[model samples]
Target: MSRIGYARVSTIDQDLETQIVKLKAEGCDIIRSEKVSGASRDGRAELATIIDFLRPGDELVVTRLDRLGRDTRDVLNLIYECEQKAAFVTVLDPHVSTRGEMGHIVLTVLGMVAQMERRFIKERQREGIEQAKRQGVYLGGKARLDHQKVKDMHEGGAGASEIARAVGCSRMQIYRILQSNR
Candidate 1:
């Protein structure tokens, strides 16, 4: 049986090294990873590939249950899909697995807890932002894109592709900026 590791980070700024190290130490035969949110399965091509490539007796491993997914239904569906393929899942951090009936029960409860924790985190973040706004201290998050730079470049007759490269953003973003200024 092959132990295939899957690592994921919620954002591009987050590092995957920690998860990678744990999976490696766990003796994962192959590792697939991506920088994407685990809130849902969307935009997780690497994960989808691992699931599709799974064979009987294969093991899908991750550092934690949250790394698998933040949504309980998504996690359970992933586990079910792996099981349907005659494969199983191994959670390194919690040392959980879906190797037997008991494992399934444990993972189910853990999945619920992970989802609940995610909701709590979001609720807390929202509350903090609201408090900051009420105190007039919320200047809002810094813009990653320079709208002024984009405007100047576009006004200078630079094409969408040129502005995109110069601003280090997508052409779609450039188009939106230009359109909004019109």
Candidate 2:
């Protein structure tokens, strides 16, 4: 049976080293990692690959249950998929495994807790943003493209495609900026 490992981080800035190290130490034969949100399985290509490549006797390992996913439904669905493949999932931190009957019950409870914690985090973030707005200190997210530059380029007879390339933005963004100006 092969022991496979999976690691994930929500942001590009976050480190996956700790999880990787732990998984390696746990005797994982192969490891796959990605820098992406665990809130949903949408963009997690590495995780999708691991799931697709799982074999009957393979064991998927993660540092924590939340590392697999923050959504209870998503986590449960992943576990079900693993079960369908006749594979096992092991969470190192809480030391839970799908190799036993009790593990399923405990994992379900932990998954619910993780989802609840994510909701709490988002609620606190919304409250903080609201407070900041009330204090007139919230400037909102930073713009990825310079609107002024885009406007200037368009006004200077630059085509949407040319302006997009020059401004380091998508053609759709250039169109939006031009449309907003009109």
- lDDT of each residue in 54-151, candidate 2, tens digit only: 99989999999999999999999999999999999999989999999999999999999999999999999999999999999999987767898899
Steric overlap count per candidate:
0, 0
Query: Any idea what lDDT model 2 has?
Result: 0.92
Residue-by-residue lDDT tens digits, candidate 1, 13-66: 689999999999999999999887899998899999999999999999999999
Q: Which ten residues in a row have the lowest lDDT in candidate 1?
A: 164-173
lDDT at 82, model 2: 97
Question: Which residue pairs clash in candidate 2?
Answer: none
lDDT, residue 74, model 1: 100
Cα-based TM-score, every candidate? 0.83, 0.80
**Model 2 residue 88 CA deviation in Å:** 0.2
